[model samples]
Target: MALPSPPLFIVFNASSGGADAEQASGRVGDLLTAAGRPHEIIRVRGDEELTRATVRASHAAREAHGAVVAAGGDGTLNAVAQVVWNADQVMGVLPQGTFNYFGRTHGMPTALDDSVAALLSAREQAVTVGLLGERVFLVNASVGLYPRLLEERESAKRRFGRRRVVALLSGLGTILRGGSVLTLELSVEGQTRVVRTRTLFVGNNELQLQEIGLRHAVDVEQGRLAAITLQPVSTLRTLWLLIRGALGRLDGAEGVDSFAFDQLVVRMRRRVRWVKVALDGEVLRMPPPLVFRTAPRPLRLLLPAAEAEEGSA
Candidate 1:
């Protein structure tokens, strides 16, 4: 089988691994070189560099006609994906940052050498990306308390271990037990429903509870978004529901709710200055009202060949 036309890839925030992208890039670079792949490596310093590199890479994807590989976490990926997605460019991931829930969930390898080897050896798949107020996300788009807490946790993840275990723990505690109970209105399928909830989630993909202390989504190619909201209730009951989810016992529970839709519109009970939204792992604010829609099959992603052959597709 011939490779799907060797692609030119752009890596954003290659220095995101903390020290420098040297070891990460070098290890991956060696593999690509051995595979006789053609690619480019660009270090993104700040917001400007991020924008420039992404746009250039997107245009290059059209002119040179190649895929853009976002090498960082969710934030960096969002910045780059927004530029190339739907602009006739395929997007890819390297998973060089914390958690990499979205990447690993999609069978993207974690180790630098293996991930690159697999990425270069992978076949492309049609996957959906999420759009939350001009920003693009590979896995999910979230608001209310969780996004706020995620910002602080990301730094801690960098300082500690890139696994982000502590942050996930702290985040789970903060959102479930300590999260805000705000009134929200949703417009789905042209029917608006109102509810007072502790947290609001609209996923380009759904999170499976069977995986404890783990975040994995339903396939992005499903062409739909999954939603879950919690109504204000006793703290203990809330804790129990979480425990159920943690212990893999949540099914048709009383306080738990989940739904799937193609589009969602959400507004908080209070009109604050701005509401924070977490895309992938990047945090940004959604001003007052947020309109979310599914971009189904908007991105063509390259995946490990084994995934495609083993009935994983």
Candidate 2:
């Protein structure tokens, strides 16, 4: 049986990845009709319409006492998240992105039927977000080769299929070849920590501790940020760890400095080259010396498998 009030808003990306958003809408509508969950499919017409439309959806969900289910990729998720963060609405994701980092980490369903089933059954949690002033991110925020590599990935996605592995290989290859590492003069837990590295990752929830070289298991929902600062012993060694980490072995590497903290401030030394940054999967060109902080219980999100697993633990 469906809840008294069904999901009132499903943010649709009709032009997402050039796939017919209407197709996704129709398919999801079929699921909703079958499951008896009430929802409205919102088609975003233009970038200019996003803010207003998002706000409108947020308001509608609140009035209907329903959830706002994001129906596209990370970029679309970020957009919908902006308006619905603090309001009385639950957030659900239907995972249709090239790399659904947040969804994959949480064990979200990939198939349409299974994904909708999870959404209809899951409990909601007030999820934390990594915030940079006005910017809010559900996953990690990073600077360096991360964002540039994403640009390359998008280009690769266009050239190859969205599911191609070579796009990842290309990004991995770029990271393996030494890119310009930067220095961050920062403070942690009221002490000074100076870091110099090419890869700086601030994970908001949990750093995906894979079978990779990174050995530390850091949890983000514990009201802290997990940070990994890396210094290459040698270019070759860095490449080895990167490959191992990609293969899920980063937690065991020696040169990787991992820690948990409430905030991080990076101090810039000079005008750096191409500071391509990322807030989740959305890429950005950022000015140096970024400040990152955690907003505790910032947004309510559907956590099906992960929350179930957490309860069992």
Judge candidate 1 at residue 93 and give its lDDT.
Answer: 80
Across 14-127, the per-residue lDDT of candidate 1 in tens digits comes to: 545455576666666777777878888776765668888887777777777688888877667777778777575777888866657667766888787777877876777766
Q: What is the lDDT of residue 259 in candidate 1?
A: 72
Q: How does model 2 fare in lDDT?
A: 0.71
Q: How far is 70's C-alpha from truth in model 1 (Å)?
A: 1.4
lDDT of each: 0.70, 0.71
- Cα lDDT for residue 292, candidate 1: 82
Candidate 2 per-residue C-alpha lDDT over 34-81 given as tens digits, one digit per residue, 9 for 90 to 100? 888888878775446666777888888888788887876777777778
Lowest lDDT block of 10, candidate 2: 209-218
lDDT, model 2, position 197: 81
Candidate number of the best lDDT: 2
The backbone clash count of each candidate, in order, is 0, 16
Q: How does candidate 2 fare on TM-score?
A: 0.86
Name every residue pair that clashes in candidate 1. none
Please estimate how well model 1 matches the true structure, expressed as its whole-model Cα lDDT.
0.70
Model 1 segments more than 4 A misplaced: 1-5, 15-20, 46-48, 158-161, 172-177, 206-221, 308-313
